[model samples]
Target: MNILIFFPSIDNGGPTNVVLSLLKGLNKNKNINIHAVYFWGDNDNNLDVINSCCDSIYKLDKVNLKSLYKLLAIIKEIKPDIVHSHCLVPDFFNYILSLCYSYKSVSTLHCNLDEDYINEYGFIKSHSYKFIHKYILMKINNVVSVSKSVLKAIPEVKAKTILNGIEELKTPLYKDNLDVINLLYVGRLIKRKNISFLISCITEINKIRNKKIKLTIVGDGELKSILKIKSGKNISFIDFNDNPFACGVENTFFINPSLSEGMPIAVLEALSLGLPVLLSSIPAHIEINDKMTDGVQLFDFNFESINNAIESMLIDCNNIGYRNKIKSQFQDNFSLNTMSDNYVLEYKLMLEG
Candidate 1:
């Protein structure tokens, strides 16, 4: 099977990681010939890993009518059996191409942005985004959502809910039971991440414990400077990396205070490493049952609530036994093999149809 994966850029993020994991795992299958096309400008250095894993790669340059002519030419050449696009823009382009010619196309919705993201990103308030997206789903052969939360955003659309999987790595050997508690936040530092609330939670937790809590926030973004200044003693920030699981697993606790999330892989990595998770009371977080994770706790996106949850974890650290059990369950449900196999199955179904 010849497959084409389209994404905006290969920059380090959840979508990129998900696609890379799929490409890497799927490449090992001798039956598949996978290719990746990205829109970002030429970056041979960034494309090295993708080129190594895929059969071919392409880039989009201009946005005018001429670009569409180039796109159609590329499609005519590759004639991909299955075109799997990630995110909104690529889906739109796939929708246009599907109308022009006969091809099996699939889109993976990574964000739960019904209207929130459109507004936040300054996209026109007009329902055009939804209209185009719905039109694509109605016309395209298949669509996949990374999480139930993401699925809910496009209700009634013909789509499958396939959870994103984490690459299985050797679990970290050391579990911190040191004097100072380690709090970790792993994700892009943005308003949606609720970094401010995380900082407030740390301050509140310090007040209750009357002790120093070491914090290591992984992932850089626009709010880096603000976070650094607001960070109390013993807190530090690290830039985002393609592989952040190891960095986050080093800490004792992983805090996800995001206002929204589409199956955060960081939480999964933390749980897999036996690090307790403290997640905000977002719909996405609720979908993942923490009772399965003994030490994982959920709280409203408030400092007091987060502080209480942290205190609960600090008080009963052995609860991590349950968290480890949950992590194992996640591994069974969301391993890279399971996710990639599901896509392969989906592709077969599309072809059969």
Candidate 2:
């Protein structure tokens, strides 16, 4: 079946990794055709995923109004069996196409579009926008979300909450070097992510324990320059990489003290690799902690809580029972194949209805 997948970019963030993995992991039985329309440059890195997996990829200048005409023409030609859009841009276009075409349409609300956040995004802040979201949710054949917290933000629209997936490693790494327990944070250096809070955690933790804690923050964003100037000892930053899982192995803890999130693919990947996670007590993080234990721990978005969690975990980093429990739960349920199969089923349902 032909499936057109729309998202902001395949170049950055958890959604990017989720999209690429899903594009590659879906059914081998079906004649799967993927149409990706993104808002970023079609660089070699981005095309690597598309060329290897998708049937066709288009990176249009999203800000250009004329692109809509071209986009409509392409959709009309593809005549896909189903259309799946991830964010606001695709949401609007898919609605437009649904009006002109006969194919079924589906959308994933990957983030919280609550009044608080919507207010910051211009005209999207209006009551009419909320109406449109509800209208689409009622009209669209199937609606899926990465986090229940995201769905809760828009209570009028009931949605199926499917935790994002990750591919587990066959051989998990165990590096218990006392000199350096590598702490990792994966995501853009944006305000909402609470990047500064991480630094505070590290500093406070060191003050209490005086242990060697090195941090690697993977991903660049709007706040990079100021963040660069502010960063202290043992903290480093890298641009968003498609292969961020490389860092998952041997990392003592995956830390994400974000103000908000959909289900974070990074945390899932880390847990899949048997790395313990320390995340903000956001609903998305709490929901993905399948073990129901503090193995996948949570703390408030503050230095005190983060420092306390780190210090407490340090005392038991080698607790075999805790590690095994986390590893088993992540591998069994959050595997990439499981998520892809669930999505494929959703698509089939849309086609049928």
Candidate 3:
């Protein structure tokens, strides 16, 4: 089976990680041939790994007629049995392209578009994106959402749920009973992330705890300069990294205090590394919390709750073999192996239909 995956871009983000994991997992299947194509976004960290997984890859200049024409040329050459795409532009083009081609189309809904666009572009454009997205969605053959929370943006569409996954990290590292707890946040710095809320919470947590909390935010964003100004010596920052774990995942409590998410891959990556995570009480994070008995905890945006979560994480992290238990659950459920199996089933459904 030949499968072609298209993305508007492949930057350092959750959706891109999902595509990379999908390619790697599906590549292992002897019956399958993978082709990965992207425009405008590049990842120095994962390009080689992505190259290893795909039968072929195309990194076009930008999302334009020229690129689309080039993509169509590749599709004509491969004659892929199914074409999978991510994000808005690729979703629209894949649907339009499928009209002239015989192959089926699949799109993964990576974010709550209504909430995402409202935060990124404001009221008017958010609705515009929503209307356009729903129209394009109706024309696509299959739609997949990373979490049920994301489906709220388009209740009319019967989108299937496929939990996002990542390949396991090489080593699960933990530094025990340290005087300082390393707190980590990774993702694009954007309005919806509300990262300032997180920095404030971490600042308040340090005021009362002897086991001091230090937040290491690993990503570049519009708010980087503003956030750095508000932060203190305890807070550190790294420019956007395709591999955030390179900063060191050891003895860290990964935290995502985002206002919204669609199965955040950074959270999944943290779990794979055996780092207990404290997440905001968003519907998406709650879904992940509900799946497990330990290692994942939900906290409100307030200082008290986040402080309590850190204390709880310290206790949990110190438990003998707790990291191993966390990594084990991640392997059994959220790993790329499981994600590929579920996606392959969806592909079969599309092909058989």
Candidate 4:
């Protein structure tokens, strides 16, 4: 079978990682051919990896009217058995093209479109975003949500829940002197992410714990300037990294204080490295803790709650053996192999249906 994967771009983000993981995992299948196309991107790290994963790659320059025609032309040429897409724009075009094409179409709903658009675009514009997204999603041939939280977001559409997975590399037990506890947050520094509060909570945490807390904020966004203003030397910011297991994995704890998430890839990457995670008690994170991962702990979006959770982890830090269990749990549930196998099944079902 020939499968063509489509996405808006190949940036170093969760959606891109999903595309990469799917491509890499599916590329191993001898019976199937994997092809991929993207609108625009410049993440060289991911670009190289994507090039190596797919049998063919199409760069459409940018998302525009001309690109739409270009994409339609590619679909005509490829004549894939199934066309699977990621992200909003690609999903839209994939659905649009499906009207005139014979190939089965599938799209991965990476986040809760309603809340996500509200956070990014705000009230009025968000309505339009939500309306358009809902329409396209409903019309799409097959829909897959990265988490049950996301699946719940769109009750109108029939979507299969397949939680996002990550590429796990073998990591040795790493401790950065144990004097400083590295708290990591990977992904965009957006308002809804509530990262500013995370930085402030570290202050209260440091005051209580004997060890100082260091926060390494990864990814860039509009909130970058605000986060810089709010943070001191203890908090350092890095541009977007494909890696979330920065600093030292053993001493580091991944903390995401987002108001929402849809199976965040960074959290999975950190867990793969056996880094304990303290996530905001959002539905998505709660779903992960309750059903998916054993190592994740949820904290309410408050200083007391976050500080207490940090203190508990710090107290239990010396019991390094548990980190291995976290890594093992990751392999069991959120590994790329498991996700790919599920997607392969879904692809077959889409064809059969």
Question: Which of 3 and 4 is the better model by lDDT?
Answer: 3
For candidate 4, write residues 1-353 as lDDT tens digits: 89999998887777888888988889888888888999887888888888887888999966788888998898888889998988778888888888988889888999888778899899999888778888898998889999988766679999888888777966465557677777888888899888888888887666666457888888899999988998877888888754545454567888899988888888888888888889899988887787544567789978889877887777665675887888888888889999999999998887788
lDDT of 3 by residue, 22-120 (tens): 988998899999998888665666788778888898887666788778888999999999999998988988988999989999999999988787897
Residue 301 displacement in candidate 4 (angstroms)? 1.0
Model 3 lDDT, residue 119, Cα: 91
Best by lDDT: 3
Looking at model 3, residue 241 earns an lDDT score of 55
- Each prediction's whole-model lDDT (CA): 0.76, 0.75, 0.85, 0.83
How many clashes would you count in candidate 4?
0
lDDT of 4 at 303: 80
- Candidate 2 per-residue lDDT, tens place, 246-352, comes to 65446478888888888888787777766788888888887876444646777886667777787677766767677777777886677788888888888777777
Query: What is the Cα root-mean-square deviation between model 1 and the actual structure?
Result: 2.7
lDDT of 3 at 269: 88
Error of 4 at 290 (Å): 1.9
Could you tell me the lDDT of residue 13 within candidate 3?
Answer: 70
How far does residue 10 in candidate 2 sit from its true spot (Å)? 2.6
The per-residue C-alpha lDDT of model 4 at residue 213 equals 82
lDDT of 3: 0.85
lDDT of candidate 1 at residue 78, scale 0 to 100: 84
User: Which is the better candidate, 1 or 3, if ranked by TM-score?
Assistant: 3
State residue 194's C-alpha deviation in candidate 4, in Å: 0.7
